[model samples]
Target: MNNYLTPNFAFANMIPVHAQGSRVWDQAGKEYVDFSGGIAVNALGHCHPVLVDTLTDQAKKLWHASNIYTTEPAQQLAKLLVDHTFADKVFFANSGAEANEAAFKLARKYAYEHYGAQKNEIIACVNGFHGRTLFTVSVGGQSKYQEGFAPLPEGISHIPYNNIEALKNTINERTCAVVLELVQGESGVLPAQVEFVQAARQLCDQYQSLLVFDEVQTGMGRTGKLFAYEHYGVSPDILSSAKALGAGFPIGAMLTTDKVAPSFGVGSHGSTFGGNPLACAVGCAAFNIINDQKTYENINKQSQALINELNVIGQSTGLFKEVRGKGLLVGCVLTDQYTNQAGEITKIALEQGLMLLQAGGSVLRFAPSLLLTDEDRQEGIKRFEQACQNFLSHY
Candidate 1:
């Protein structure tokens, strides 16, 4: 009814509202399973008690403070991140795009300062969706986001994902950085092979280019690790994190080792609302809850459950051609007959009371909350299967 505040989304015609936990109630108050989890930002699900308390406590104490003065919440959150990850330093922002912006800037600055202006080119993988910022958009491989927004920033190159040879061929001495998503979430939940990631690291070293991991979608325990790089046992010089980092509270961060830390000085880069206490406090609470053995195990368990259930449904109906991805990030590839039906199925599933997402053109993607319960997992899948069946029957 109200399109003023909403841009036309791909599913604008049938999208509905009202969500909590693993379920949502639409405008008609019809109950639906929430398999989307706000595109995987709701790691703890809707209105998690821990996050609510943390946000409430911080809100009461302090909400907004200019960056002129440091706050304990931001400091503590940064400290926790540095302690847990490979980062020796951290910069906070309000979203994944902002975090990536910082990462891009830092990488370029490091290269310029250490080498020269000649080493300012950025190499990213094709189909990698970094962010929407001018610099990040150019750095990101997909041109759809950059369409009607050109001319894009210069000196950026894109290589195919998981193509070690292509990456090696493209990332050379003049390259300032190689940006990659450990798992390309929007491109279809495709996890880069370990050898590919490790080789990227080696090539960066060989070429003296900074390796930047855009872990915006795979961070904060979404991949059964605090950061997906941990799984491959290869660390990047710089890393960007967001999405589930705040468990639905908007926050983002760029983490870096000491080697690339000095490039970013005071006034070099800053966000007025970055590292605000309210978001950081909530982020700290979210991180504490997620960065644990039990939490990681839960992610793996729930992910396997969802994947297995979806596979069974796919096999039974032959609606899906393939299943891929890891931990909670998964994709159900629709058969050629069902490929064009992804958007249709999404609409029908919403009508049937189950929320889901799409990655690229031919897959029904699911990025549910990492801590989703087994019962909810099964129920969500059951509802999704029913929606698929209903749509197939209608067609």
Candidate 2:
């Protein structure tokens, strides 16, 4: 088959034709237990009934009106977010990159309007993953993403993540904002230390800089909480959320307090298809389902079960060095003997009817549904163990 799509992504061999709950079927009718969750976008699993109903109803009503006029679904969704979280205002976008772009711009604009033009620098965590936009990719710590995108945005620098001393030394009056992911999801599933987050809050306050949390991968109950910041007991000035926000629909949001919200005043930033009726309707449904206390409790319970299984697998096979991460977003770090073989293992797992992901080259990542059933969990683990055993036998 001649491929017409861009060559940016390394395409997988399987062609998934259908999915439901925690399972997906390829074109050849082969079934796979989906542990990737569409890279953490499918919070309620594929084709969740609530989200489906909401989308269908909204589709019949209205589709797009742009930002010229406000819609009921958008207003209702925004209110829901504000009521549940620390945000007093919300801005919707089409993707995580757009949400983060709005956040970075707001941080800079807020600083320039309140402080001055000189206070324009933005500090981010080293090895943090933000988004794919020019500004966001620059703000992201990885050099590989920024290799060809130069004359990239300036006034962005990175410090070693969780390094309180480095953060203390680097942030000052010139810094407009300090952006970080509560859980660095891409480079590796490394959660920020509590002390480090607290120090960041203190230092940002001391320097009058905004604290931005990129919760694109950790929001919407991925970490057994509605938001990852809840676990840390700290609040950010600006927060970006996506992935699971719309339960697999393409939607993103930037949230902030009233104090920092004014900087993004009229005509500052906008999105064309953002805050549309269909997307917001789905977002509202997903939020309602995920924000319950029972949901959080179940997520934590399922997370522990998954972790325990992974630990057992590690000990039995001697293939894993550590299993880390919060809630369903888990990472299994390979032992030194299997260095940089995460991708290979993922491919092998695919052959065994298990869908998995790799954070980089050394960490096998799992971002399953928050409501994963025990049956699916057992099946997934069985398939994954077989994949690991198969790989080991060859080695």
Candidate 3:
């Protein structure tokens, strides 16, 4: 038994002693392919040489400099974000939840200050995962996460993803923001239909409401673009990014255009460790590497290969109904007969020296490293095939 106090995480039995790139090793010397990539946080892969070097060099210089003082790493990273994307300003936080919290508050504040409190409704897609904070979970659109946390925050509404009609019906002059996931990562890797996303942009524009994209899971090259919005030719007024920003060093950021950024004025909102030097340094390194055109090409190719291979396996075994999502953030939707076995399939995959993640009850989410090597991909698929065969035998 451990001394930790936490809710059930359904942790794997294997305790990894070490990891490098796309592989992990247990204390017992069992090796496993790391396809989960710490739930998509290791965008550059585990202990990437460049990231490790950046973190170490920054550690030798400075680690934490509270929001009281500006830090160079933070400034550099912020500049990079501003230069590369639609954002004109950036605010750092420690996790996706904090970044999303900031985004939510900023949206409300901007609306309240500019348009009045009447325009304060936020609309998010059903089954879209944001973060674990009270405000985030309240606005996350999944009721089960908020069952015991009432009376939850008000003025937030949920809508079926990709239903442009429902979204149009929901948004009025009162709607303050519409938060969306280009690829819904937690429930299943459901990519937003292009038409629906374009409609969202139009609706927000028609109503003068802010469009927020919770890119916490789909950002930082997860979808073959620096941000998933690039794929659809739509951008969010407020974007929340994390998970992979620091490449395992822990960082989050809320980015917005200049017009809406000033709404978050001095002394309005802040965090102590939001722009820590260590996290920023690593984030900068990861951002520079991932922002490269070559990196995007590699991810697109690798993702297509994995998707093709998984479809081939599905066709051969009839185990999955469809494979969905973009770039490395793909999902294999299991056949109805095997829907409830997603967790068990993951466990058996572990037994076969593979690491995988399940989204909701039926979709197997593959959020592996953007730098996933050809060799690791082949090896992981081999392990997964064996695991599938083993699973079918029992079923």
Instruction: Find the candidate with the highest TM-score and give its number.
Output: 2
Estimated TM-score for each candidate: 0.97, 0.99, 0.98
Q: Candidate 3, residues 18-130: lDDT per residue as tens digits? A: 99999999989999999999999998888899988898899999988798899999999999999999999999999999999999999999999999979999999887788
Residue 232 lDDT (model 3): 93
The per-candidate count of clashes, in order, stands at 1, 0, 0
TM-score of 2: 0.99
lDDT of 1 by residue, 62-99 (tens): 98897998899999999999999999999999999999
> Which segments of candidate 2 are over 4 A away from where they belong?
none
lDDT at residue 63 of model 3 (Cα atoms): 83
Clashes of 1: 1
Q: Tens digits of per-residue lDDT for model 2 on 178-273?
A: 999999999879999999999999999999999999999999999998999999999999999999999899999999999999998789899999
Pick the winner on lDDT between candidates 1 and 3. Answer: 3
Question: Alpha-carbon error at 318 in model 2, in Å?
Answer: 1.1
Best by lDDT: 2
